[model samples]
Target: MINDEDERFNSELDEWRKLPVFKQALVILHLVEHIIEGIHLDDPHPSTHYKLRLYERYTRQMMENALLIPSEIATADSTDLYDHKMENATIIRKAAKEIIADSKGLQASGYKEAEYLELLYDAVEEFRPLFAEWVQSFSTKNFIIDRWGLFNPPGVSYDDPVDTMSFDSKSFLRDLEDDWDDGDDDDLI
Candidate 1:
């Protein structure tokens, strides 16, 4: 019997066309990079499969933030300078989808770092009259960690998530288990 998660993921992947083009692009591109980085053989390993499984767990998280462009811009209470990041994120996701669909798309175009750098060029080129000022605003600000692992100015304090590699086995052994609880309590007569 198929469970909820499998049913949901299968349905989503099957109905990928319904999602915004950019969003599909983002996720697909992310997966593509994952494959290239992990399964390309030159830098490949068995852990690639494991990492993909790990990535699947957080797949929905990216989709949740795709609309921040319109959301931030439309409902922004602050200046008009930096609202583009939201839209840029959306485009980045879209482009990623495109890249995933066809690696030859941008990689063939000589993008050094195909994931973020590919889109970064367009963003930089289209700057000014388009969004140069906003980009400048971001530059001037301090490097606060963004949800995407990039930096930002002091805005919200986000909890940096620790990866699996950070787990301390020794500490886990020392503190996480209390197996001595078979309390052979002496019920003295």
Candidate 2:
């Protein structure tokens, strides 16, 4: 009995697995960079801790995917691919540093923290077009567009609601215990 969230994640993973290895690496790197940027924005907002935790989880997952890319692309090696991979690593590192520095600066500015975060958000929004242009110069543009659905398919709203309703953790754990007690390992899969 898979839930909607599980199904959605499975679908995303399936799509991710279909990408060329290099594209898969780029997508994960891009997602990590974006998550780092988002984490910076949410760091000062206490009310956004849940969102921050989600970003951290995503970053960890992206890092795992990146670490797995070597095996995925074991047979594919070219000068161009090597250069692109090196360039992407450099870019991701630099972006992460910049985001961190910006967040630190905002924190130290003596301005109200929320106000500073709002300003930082505005700055990012203003520069989004330039960021898009920079992204277009990379091999990742198509991969990003495809994975993120930058262009909507029919009947899918960009503002689609996410499933956020929570369930009791204890109940879920008890159900798992009951399944195991019944000698049913099927649910473990």
Model 1 TM-score is: 0.23
Task: Give model 2 RMSD, 1 decimal.
Answer: 17.7
Model 1: per-residue Cα lDDT at residue 78: 29
RMSD of each: 17.5, 17.7
Query: Which pairs clash in the backbone of model 2?
Result: none
Encode model 2's per-residue lDDT on 1-189: one tens digit a residue: 447657986775555344344443454445444544554543567756755555455445445544444333332222123224334444543443454454545344322345535444454444344334433444421111112434333343445543211233466799978966875446558
Question: Which candidate wins on TM-score?
Answer: 2
How do the residues 1-189 of candidate 1 rate in per-residue lDDT, one tens digit apiece?
236656986775544233343333344344444434432222267765655444443333332333333233223212222323443544544533433334333343332455554443343233222333333334323222345534333443335543322334466576635423434323322
- The lDDT per prediction is 0.38, 0.44
Question: What's the C-alpha lDDT at position 47 in model 2?
Answer: 50
Q: Ten consecutive residues with minimal summed lDDT in candidate 2?
A: 138-147
